[model samples]
Target chain A: MTQPTAAVLLIGDELLSGRTRDINLQQIAQYLEPIGIPVRECRTVPDIEEEIVAAVNALRAKYTYVFTTGGIGPTHDDITADAIAAAFGTGISEHPEVLAEMAERYKAMNTDFTPARRRMARIPHGAKIVKNPVSGAPGFQMENVFTMAGVPQIARAMLEDIGPRLEGGARVHKVQLRGPGLREGDLAEPLGAIAKAYPDVSIGSYPWYLGTGDNGVALVARSTDTVRLETVRGELEALMRGLGVEPIPDPL
Target chain B: MTQPTAAVLLIGDELLSGRTRDINLQQIAQYLEPIGIPVRECRTVPDIEEEIVAAVNALRAKYTYVFTTGGIGPTHDDITADAIAAAFGTGISEHPEVLAEMAERYKAMNTDFTPARRRMARIPHGAKIVKNPVSGAPGFQMENVFTMAGVPQIARAMLEDIGPRLEGGARVHKVQLRGPGLREGDLAEPLGAIAKAYPDVSIGSYPWYLGTGDNGVALVARSTDTVRLETVRGELEALMRGLGVEPIPDPL
Candidate 1:
C-alpha cells in the first residue's frame, strides 16, 4: 500500500495575525506520527469562505486524510461548517439530534438555548458526527475530511474519537544524536556520506545557536525500518567520535 | 492601492515528523503585522524538492511577498536552493563573495572547508543576499521571495534586514476583551450583531477551556480604523457586563 499521508488545514484569522501562536499543527503531527499516518503538509488560512473552501478542496483531494481546526463556533465569524459544505457542494442544515442534545445541556445548566447557540447544530449533509464530549458543538466528518474545534485542548480531545477511524501504515521510528561542540559545517561531509549510503533513511541536521555563535548540532534519522534506524544511530555516534566532539545525551 | 499581504512557507521534515515545533511562522507574522503587511496565509511542507518548488510558485504568485524558512543548511537534505532555482527557472552557482567569507570564517575557527561546507556558498542567479549574522551561509532573495535560515534566531535576525525592503500599508488596530464567567453561548448574539454592524472590522471570539469546561471567552476586534476599533471594544465590554459577567483584565 502506498503510505498513507495526511494534510492539516488550519482556518482562522487569529493564527495568521500573529495575535495567537498556533500549537495545533505540532499537536496534530505528533498525534498522527505514532499512528503511522504522517502529516505531509499543513496550511493556515484566514477566516474567509473562498480561501477556506479552496484549501479544503485542494487538501482533501491530495491526502489520504484532511483535518481542519477552527471557525466552527456559535458566532458570525465561525464559517467553517458552511465553507466545508460549499467545498463538497453539499447542503448544510441544523441536525435535530445535535440540536436536541445541546438544548437539553443548556437547560440543565439553567441557560436559555439562544438561536446563536443553536447554530452549533448545523451539519453538512451526509457527514458523520465527530463527537465532542468537552463541548456540545459537534464536528462533522465529510468523506476523508475531519473537522474539529480550534481551541487546542478541544482539538486535542477530538483526536481520541478520530484515532479509531484512521488506518495507519508501518510505524516510523526515529533516533536522535546530539554533539555539544559540533556544528552543521563540521558534520555535513560525513553525514552526507552516511545519508548517501542509507538511501531509505531520512536524516536531518539541525544546528542550535545562542545568537552569537553555535552551541551544538542535533542529528535525527527517521525510517520505518527499525534495524536501519539503529544502524544509522551507530554511524551517527561513530561520526561524532571521529570528530572529537563527544555526543551529548540530549540537546533538546 | 490594495493592501500588501504576505505568505510564509516553512520547509522541514523535522516539523512534519513532529520532531521540532515551528516558531518561524509566528515570528514572521508578528514582525510583519506592525509593518502593515499582514501574513495572510502560511504553509508548511517537508524537505522535498518538488513540494518546495510547487509551494514557492503557488505562494509567490498569490501573495505580495513570500518568506521561506528551512532546508538552506549544508546537508544532504538541504535542497531549498535548488528547489527555489527550479521554481524561478534559474541556474544556481557558488557566489565568490559568500564562498570567500565562509572559507575565511571556517579557517579562523580552525575548521576544514570540505565540499559539504562549500555547499553553503551556492546562490541562485540574480538573487540578492539575505544576510545571516548568526551563520556564514547567507540566505537569498529572489524576486518577491525572501529565503532565510531555518534556525529560529537566525530567521529572527534576518528580519532586521528585510523590514526596510517591504512597502507596508495602513496599520491595523486591535482591541481585546475578556469575560471571566462568560461563554460563547452567552455573547454569541450580541457579538454577531456587532460583527454585522462593523463590516470593515474583523471580530474574533476565542473560548479558552481547562479540559473539563470553559474558563472564559476572549473577544477581539481588529480594523485599520482606530476609532472603530475603540467603539467595538466598548461594545464588547458592555456585552459582557450586560450578562452580569465581569470582564477580566487579561486572559492570554
Candidate 2:
C-alpha cells in the first residue's frame, strides 16, 4: 500500500526574517515519521496573505494532508485563519462555543474579555477545533489542513492532539553509522556500490564537523522495511571496519 | 525599483527524517535580508530527483534568484547537480578545470582520486564554479540557481562568494519593542491601528516564552524606509509605556 504523504507550511515573517528559528517543521515531521505519513515537502512563507493562500492551496492540492504552523494568534499579523478560509473559498465567523471557552477562561483569570482577545474565537466555517490546553485559543482543522500556534512550546503542545487524528501507512526505520576520522570522499565508491546493490534502502553519507580538525562521516540508511534496514546496517558497519575505522554505536 | 527576491531549496532525506535540523535556511535568509533581496520563500525536499527538479524549476521562475543547499556532495545520494541540469534541460559532464583541481588536491594530500571522487567535478554545462576553500569540491551556479554544499560550514562558506554577485534594492530597517509582562492580546488593537496607519511598514507580534508564566510579546516593525521605521518605534514605545510597562531598549 502507498503511504499517505503530507506537506508542512510554516507561516510568519519572524521565521523568514531570521528573527525566529523554526522548530515546528521538525516537530511535525518527527511526529509523522513513525505514523507512516512522511512529510514530502515543507515551505516557509512570510505574513503576506497572497503568499499564504497560494502556498496553502498549492500544497493542499498536492499532498494527502497539510499541517501549518504559525499565525494563529491575537494580533494583526495573525492572518493564517482568514487566509486558509480564503484559500478554501469559505466564510469565517466567531464560533459561540470557542467564544464561550475564551470568555470563561478570562473570567477564571479575572481578566477583561476584550474585543482583541475575542479574535481568537474566530473559526472558518465547517472546521473542527484542534484543542489547545497550553493557551485558551484553540487551533482549528479546516478540511485536511491543520493550523496551530507559532510559539515553539504552544506549537509542540498542540501536536499531541494532532498526532492521533492522522492515519499513517508505513513506519520508517533509520540507522546512523559513524566512525572516527571518516571522510565522505573516502567512502563514496564503496557506499555507492552498496546503495546500488540494495535499491530498497536509501543510503546517504554526510560529513559531521565537531571542530576545525575534528570531523567524521555519518552514514545513514533508511527504509520502511525493518529487515532491510538492519541488513544494510550490518553491511555499513563492515564497510567502515574495512576502512580501518570501527563503527561507533549510537550513544543513548 | 523593487528589490530582487530569492527562494531557498534544502535537499536531503536526513532533513525530512528529522535526523538533522536545518540552519541553512536562516543562514541564507539572513545573508540576503540585509542585501535588500528578501527570501520570499523557502522549500525543503527529499533526495528524490523529480521533487528536486520540480521545486527548482518553480522557484527559479518565480524568484530573481534560487539558492539550493545539500545534495551536492560525492555520495550516491548527491543528485542535485544532475537534477538541476535536468531542470534547465541542459547537458552535464565533468568539467576539466574542476577535475584538474580535485586531482591536484588529492595528489597533494596523498589520497586516492577514485571514480566516485571524480563525481564532484561534474558541473552542469554553462555554469560557473563557486570556490570551496574548506573542501576541494566547489559549488556551481546554473543560471539563477546557486547550488552549494550540504555541510553547514561549507554551505556558510560558499555564501561569501555568492553574496557579491547579486544587486540589492532596499536595505530594511528593523525595530523591536518589548517590555516585561507584555502580552499579545493586550497589544493587538493598538498594534493593528499602528500597522494600518503605516501600510508601508510590516508590523509583527511574536511571543517570547521564557518559562510557563514568564512569556512576553516582542513587537517588531520592518520597513525599507528609515524615517517610517523610527516613527513606528516611537509609537510602539509610547504604547508600551501607556500599558504600565516600560519599554526595554534593544541591547545590541
Candidate 3:
C-alpha cells in the first residue's frame, strides 16, 4: 500500500513577517513520520481569509491529511477557524463542550469569561475537538484537516491526541553516511550513479558547516524496503572511499 | 506605495523528512523586510520534479519575487534547476562562465571536475547567475525567481549578492506592546474594537509561555504610516490598562 501523504498549512502574519519562527512544521513532520504519514508539503501564509481558504482547499484535496497551526485564539487576528469554515462552506458556532471547559477553567481563576475568550469555543460545524492539555482552548478537526494551536507546546499536545486515530501506512527506513572534508564535486558522479541505480531509495546529499571553518556533506538514503536502502548505503560508503575520504556513520 | 511581496520556496525532502529544520525562510524574510520587500508566503516541497515545477510557477506568478533554496547540487535528487527550466518552458545548458569558474576552483583544489560537479554550471536560457561566494557553484535567476543552494550559509551568501539589485517598495513601520499575566480572553474584546477602529494598522496577538507556568501575550501593530501605527499602539496600551494589565514596551 502507498504511504499516506500529508500537508501542513501554517497560518499567521507573524510567521511571514519574521516576527515568529515556526517550529510546528518540523514537530508535526517528526510526529507523523513514525505513523507512516510523511508530510509532502508545507505552506505558511499570512492571516488573510482568502489565502487561508485557498490553501486549505488545495492541500485538503491533494494530500491524505492536512494539518493547520495558528489563528485559533480569541483575538481578531485569530481568523483561522473562520477561514477553515469558509473553505468547507460550513457555518461556525460556539461548541458547548469547549465553552463549558473554558468557562470552568476561567471560573476557577475568578476571570470573567469575556466574549473574546469565548471565541475560542467557536468551531466549524460538524468538526470534532482535538484536546489541548497545555492550554484551555481545544483545536478541532474538520474532515481530514486538523487545526491546532500555533504555540509549539500546545500544537504538540494536540498532535498527541490526534496521532492514535490515524491509519498509518508503510513506515519508511533511512540510512545516513557522512563524508567529511570532501567537496560535493568529488562525490557528485558516483552519488548520482548510485541514485540512478537504486531508484527505490531516495538519496540526498546535505552539506553541513562544522563552525571550525571546515565543512562536510551527509548522504541520506530513504526507502520503505530495508534491503534496497542498505544496498544503497553500502554503495555510498564505497563511493566516499573512492574519493579518498572515509565515510563516517554520522555527521557529529 | 504598497510594499513588494515575495515568497520563498524551500525544495528538499530532508526538510519534509524532519532531517533539517529550515532557517532560510526567516533569514530571507528578515533580509527582505529591511529593503521594503516583505515575504508574504513560504512553501516547502520535497525533491520531486513535478512539485518543484508547480511551486515555482505558482509562487513566481503570485509575488513580485520568488526565492527558492535547495536542489541545485550535483546529486540525482537535485532536479530544481531542470524543473525550473521546464516551469518557464525554456531549455537549460551548461553556461561557459559558470563552467570556467567551477573548473578553476576544482583545479586549485586538485580535484577532478566530474560530470556531477559540472552539472552545477547548467543555467536556464536567459537566466543570470547569482554568484555564490562560499561555494563555487553559482545560483541563478530565471526572471523573478532566485534559485540558491540548500545549505544555509550558501543560501545566505547568494541573498547578499541579490539584495542590492531588487527594487524595494515602501518600508513598513511597526510598534509592539506586551501585556504580561493577561488572559487573551480579557484583552480580546477591546483589542478587536481597537482593530476595527484602526483598519489601516494590522494588529497581531501572540501568546508566550514563560516556563514558570505563566503565559503572556504580545500585541504588534504594523502600518506604512508611523503616526497611525503609534496612535494604534497607544490605544492598544490603553486597552490593556483598561483590562487591568500593564503594557510593557517590548517583550524583552
Candidate 4:
C-alpha cells in the first residue's frame, strides 16, 4: 500500500524567537512515522493570523493530513481558532456546547468559570471538538486540519485521542544499529543498493561522534513488514562483520 | 537603531526523526537576539534538493540574513552546499584554497588526506568561507545565507567566528512580571493600553504553571532602548499592583 503523507504547522512566536524549545513536532513525527505516515514538511511561524491561515491552506491541500499546534489558549495571541475558521470561510463564535464542557470541567475542579475562562469555549461553527483530558480547553478538528495543544503532555494526549479515529496505514518497522569507528560515506553505495532492492523499505545512515576521538554510524531499515525489516537487519550484520565492526542496538 | 530580522533553515531528516535534538536554532537565536536581531521564521526540511532550494530562496528573500545548518557533511545526504549553490544559480566544485586549508588542517591532526575526504573542500562560486576552528571542514557564506555544520559545537563555534563580522543593531532590553492569582483577560484592556503607548516595544502575555497548583500569567516587555524598556516594566508593575498582584522578576 502507498504510504500517506502529513505536514506539520508549528505556530508560536516563542519558538521562532528561541525563547521556547519545541517538542511538539518531534513528538508528532515519532508518533506518525512508525505508522507509515511521514511528515513531509514542517513550518514554524509566529502567532499571526495571516501566516496561520496561509500555512494551513497550503499544507492541507498538498498533504493528506495537516496537524497544527499552538495558539488555542485564552490569551490575546490565541487566534488559531478564529484564523482557521476564516481559512475555511466559516463563522466562529462562542459555542454553547464548548461552554458547557469548559464549565463542567472547571466546576469539577472548583475553579471559577469566569467570563475570561469562558473565552476558551469559542469554537468555529460545525467543528468537532478534540477533547483535552489534562486541560479544560478542548481542541477542534475541521476537515483535515487537527488543532492540538502546544503543551507537550496535552498535545500527546490529544493526539492519542484523535490518532486512531483517522485512517492510518501499516506501521513502518525498522532495525536500527549503531557503533563507533565507521564513516557514513563508506556504506552509502551498499545501503543505496539495499534501498533500491526493497523499493518498499527505506534505509537511512546517520553518523555521530563518540567524544572519545571515535565516530559512530547507525543504519536503519524501515518497512511496513516485520520480516522484511529483519532481513535487512541480518544483511547489515553480515556487512558489519565484513568491515570488522560490531553493530550496537538502537538507542533512540 | 532598528533591529535586523533573521530566519533559519534547518536541513536534515535526523532532526525530524527525533534521532537528534536541534541546538543550532537556539544558539543562533541567543547570539542574534542580544544584538537586536529577531529571528522571523524557521523551517525544517529533509535533504531533498528541491525542498532545500525552495526554503533557501523563500527565507533569503524575506529576511535580512538567512542561516542554514546541516547537510554540509562528507556524506551523500549532505547536500546543503550543492542546494545552496543551486538556489543562487551558481556552480560548485572543490576549490583549491579550501582543499589547501583542509590539507593543512588534516596534516596538523595527522589524518590521511584521501580524495574522498577532500569532498569537504567543496564550496559554491563567489562564496566566502566561515572558518571552523574545531573541524577541518569549513562553512560557507554566500550573500545573506550562512551555511554551517550540523554538529552543535561546530555550529556554535562558527557563529562566534562570523557573528562579529555581520552588521548588528542595538540589543533589546526586556523585563518580565507575573501575577499568580490573575487571569490574562482581566489584564487585557490595561495591557492593551500599555502595548499601544509603547509602539516601539513588544508586549507578551504567557500562562505558566508554577507547580503545587499555582497557575499564573506572565507579562513581558521588550524594546531596543534600556530606558524605554525599564519604563514599560515600571508601568506594568504599577498596573499589577493596582490589581492586588505581585510582579515577579523574570528568570529569562
Candidate 5:
C-alpha cells in the first residue's frame, strides 16, 4: 500500500531574516515519521498574504495532508488565519468551542480575556480546534490544512493533540553504519547492486566529519519490513568488517 | 541608501529529506549581514536539472545577488554546472584553469585524481571560478548566481574567497527589547505609532516563552541609518521601561 504523504509550509519573515532558528521542521519530521506520514516537501515563505495563499493552495492540492506554522498570533503580522480562510474561499468566525475553552483557560490563569486574545478564537468555518495546553491560543484544523502557532511550545502541543487522530502506515525501521577508511567510489558498484538486490529496502550514504582530521561515510538501510531491514543491515555490517572498520549503531 | 538584498537557492535532496541539517544558510546570512547583504529569500530544490535552472532564473531576476549551495560534487546528482549553463543558455566545458587547480590540490593531498573526480573540473562557459581551498572541486560565479559546494566547510571557504568581490549597501543596525508580564494588545497601538513615526525603520514584535512561568514580547528595531536606529531603540527601550519591563540585551 502506498504510504500517506504530507507537506509543511513554514510562514515567517523571521526565518527568512535568519533571526529565528527553526526547530519545528525537525521535530515534526521525527514525530510524523514514526506515524508513517512521510513529509514530501517543506517550504518556508515570508508572512505575506499572497505568498501564504499561493503556498497553501498549491500544497493542499498536492499532498494528502498539509501543515502550516507561523503567522497565527494575535499581532499585526499574524495573517495565517485570514490567508487560509482566503485560500478555501471561506469566511472566518469566532469558533464557539474554541472561545469557551480560551475563556475558561484565561479565567483559570487569571489573565484578562481581552478582545485581542479573543482573536485567537476566530477560526475558519468548519474547522476543528487543536487544543493548546501550554498557551491559551489554540490551533485550527480545516480539511487537510492544520494551522499551528509559530512558537515551538504551542506548535508541539497542537501536534500532540492532532497526531493520534490521523491514520498511519507501518513504521519504517532503519539501520546505519559509519566508516572513514574507504572512498565512496570504491563501493559504488557494490552499493548499487545491494540496493538493487533488496527491492524492498533503501540504501543511502552520507559523508560527515569524523574528527582527528578524518572524513567518514555513514551507510543507512531503511525498510518497512523488519526482516528486510535487518538483512540489509547485516550486509552493511559485513561490508564494514571487510573494509577493516567497525560498524556503528544508528544514532536514532 | 538602499539595503542590499540577496536570495539563496539550495540545490540538494539531502536537505529536503531531513537527512542533512543545513548550516550553509545560517553561515551565509551571518557572513553577509556585517557586509550589508540581507538575504531576502531562500528556496531548496532537489538536484533535478530543470528545477535548478528554474530556481536560478527566478531568483537571479528577483534579487541583487543570488547564492546557491550544493550539487557541485563529482556524483551523478551533481548537475549544478550543467543546470547553471542551461539557465544561462550556454554550454559546458572542462575549463583548464579549474583542471589545473584540481590536479594541484589532489597532488598536494596525495589522493588519486580519478576520471570521476575530473568531472568536477567542468564549468559553464563564460563563468568565473570560485576557488576551493579545502577541496579540488571549484565553485563558480555566473552572472548574479554564486554556486558553491553543499558541504558547510567548502561552502564557507568559497564564501571567504568571494565575499570581498561583491557590492554592499549600508549595514543595518538592530536593537531589541523584551517586555514580560504584558500582553500583545497593550503594546499594539504604541508599537503601531512607533512604526509609523520611523518610516525608514522596520519594527517587529515576537512572543516568547520565558521558561519562568511567564510570557514575554521581543521587540526588534532595524534600520540602515545608525542615528535613526539608535533613536528608535531609545524610544522602544523607554516604552518597555514604562510598561515595567527590564528589557534584555539584543539576543542576536
Candidate 6:
C-alpha cells in the first residue's frame, strides 16, 4: 500500500524574520512518521493573508493531510483563523462552545472576557475544535487541515489531542550505518549500485564533523518493507567492507 | 525605499523525515536581515528533482533573491546541482577550477579523487562560483539564486563570500516592550489602535510563559525609519501603562 503523505504550513513573520526559530515543523514531522503519514513538503510563509490562503489551498489539495501552526493568538497580527476561513471560502465567527470554555477559564482566573480574549473563540464555520490542554484557547480542524497554535508547548498539546483521530498507513522502518574515517567519494559508486538494486528503498549519505579530527559519512536506508530493508542494509555493510572500512551502527 | 525580499528553498529528505532539524533558514534570515534583505518565505522540499526545480523557478521569479541549501554533497542523493541546472534550462559539468581544488584537497587528505567526489565540482553553465571556505566544494550563483552547502558551518562561510556582492536596501530598525503580568486580551484593543496609528510600522504581540507562575506578552515594533520606530515604541509603552501594566525592555 502507498504511504499517506502530509504537508506542513508554518505561518508567521517572526519565523521568517529570524526573531523566532521554528520548532513546530520538526515536531509535526516526527509525530506523523510513526503513525505512517510522512510529511512530504513544508512551507513557512509570512502572516500575510494572501500567502497563507494560497499555501493552505495548494497544500490541502495535494496532500492527504495539511497541518498549520502559528498565528492563532489573541492579537491583531493573529490572522490565521480568518485566513483559513478565506482559503476554504467559508464564514467565521465566535464558536459558542469555545467561547463558553474561554469564559469559564477567564472567570476562574478572575479576568474579564474581553473582545481580544474572545478572539480566540473565532472558528471557521463547520469546523471541529482541536482542544488545547495547555491553554484554554482551542485550535480547530476543517476537513484535513489541522490548525494549531504556534507556541511549542501548545502545538505539542494540540497534536496529542489530534493523534488518536488520525488513520495511518504502513509505518516506514529505517536503519543507519556509520563509516568512521571513510569518505563519501570512496563509497559513492557502491552506494549508487546498492540504491539502484533496491528501488523500493531510499538511501541517503550525510557527512558529519565532530570537533577537529573526527569526521565521517552516515549511510541511512529507509523502507516500509522490513525484509527488503534488512537485505539492502546487509549489502550496504558488504560494500563498506569491500571499500576497506568497518561499518558501525549509528549511535543516534 | 522598499526593502529587498528573499526566499529560501531547503532541499533535503532528512529535513522532512525529521532526521535533521534545519538550522540554515534561521541563519540565512539573520544573515540577510542586517544587510537590508528580509526573507519573506521559506520552503523545504525532499530531494526530488521536480520539486527542487519547481521551487527554484517559483521562488526565483517572486523574490529579489533565492537561497537554496542541501543536496549539493558528493553522494547519489545529492542532486541539487543538477536540479538547479535544469531549473535554469542549462547544461552542467565539472568546472575546471572547482575540480582542481577538490582534487588537491582529496590528495592532501590521502583520499582518492573518485568520480563521486568529482560530482561536487559540477556547476551550472554560466553561473558564477560562491566560495566555500569550510569545504573545498564551491557553491554557485545563477542570477538571483545562491546555492550553498547543507552543513551549517559551510553554509555560513558561503554567505560571507556572497554578502559583499549583494545590493541591499534600507535596514529595518526594531524595538521591543514587554508587559509583565499582562494578558494579550487586555493589550489587544490598544495594540490594534497603535498598529493603525503607525501604518508603516509592523507591530507584533508574542505571549510567553516564564516556567514559574508568570506569563505575559511581548510587543515588538519594526520599521525602516528609526525616528518613527522610536515614536511608535513610546506609544506602545504608554498604552501598556494606561492598561495598568509596566513595560520592560525585552532581555533579548
Clashing pairs in 3: none
Q: Better model by TM-score, 1 or 4?
A: 1
Rank candidates, DockQ, best first.
6, 2, 3, 1, 4, 5
TM-score of each: 0.96, 0.97, 0.96, 0.92, 0.88, 0.97
Candidate 4, lDDT over the whole model: 0.82
Output the better candidate (3/4) by lDDT: 3
Each model's lDDT comes to 0.89, 0.89, 0.89, 0.82, 0.80, 0.91
Sort candidate 3 into its docking category. Answer: medium
**Taking the tens digit of each residue's C-alpha lDDT, what string does model 1 give over A79-153?**
999999999999999998999999999999898898998988999999999888887789889999999999887
Candidate number of the best TM-score: 2
True-vs-predicted CA distance for residue B12, candidate 6, Å: 0.3
**Number of the top candidate by DockQ?**
6
**Candidate 3 on A15-131: residue-level lDDT in tens?**
888888888999999998878899999999999999999999999999999999999998999999999999999999999989999999989979898888888999999999999
lDDT of 5 by residue, B1-252 (tens): 666689888777566556676667778887888888888777777667887888789889978898899887664456789999999999999999888878888888787776657778989999998988876588999988899998888999999988978898888778877677656756765776788799888787788776786788888877778899889988888878877877786667
Worst 10 residues of 2 chain A by lDDT: A243-252
DockQ of each: 0.68, 0.70, 0.69, 0.49, 0.37, 0.75
Put down candidate 2 lDDT per residue, B1-252, tens digits, no spaces: 978999999999878877788899988888888889888899999999999999999999999999999988888999999999999999999999999999999999999998888999999999999989888799999989999998888998999998888888789888887777988888889989999999999888877878877778778888999998999999999999888888876621
lDDT value for model 2? 0.89
Model 2 alpha-carbon miss at residue B238, Å: 0.7
| Model number with the top lDDT | 6
- TM-score for the first chain of model 1? 0.96
A61-127 per-residue lDDT for model 5 (tens digits): 9888888999887666778999999999999989888889888988897877877677778999878
State which candidate, 5 or 6, has the greater TM-score. Answer: 6
Q: What shift in Å separates residue B206 of candidate 3 from its native position after superposition?
A: 0.8
Q: How many Å off is the CA of A220 in candidate 3?
A: 0.9
Q: What class would a CAPRI assessor give candidate 2's docking?
A: medium
Off by over 4 Å in 5: A169-171, A181-202, A223-235, A238-242, B1-4, B47-54, B76-79, B85-93, B180-186, B196-199, B213-215
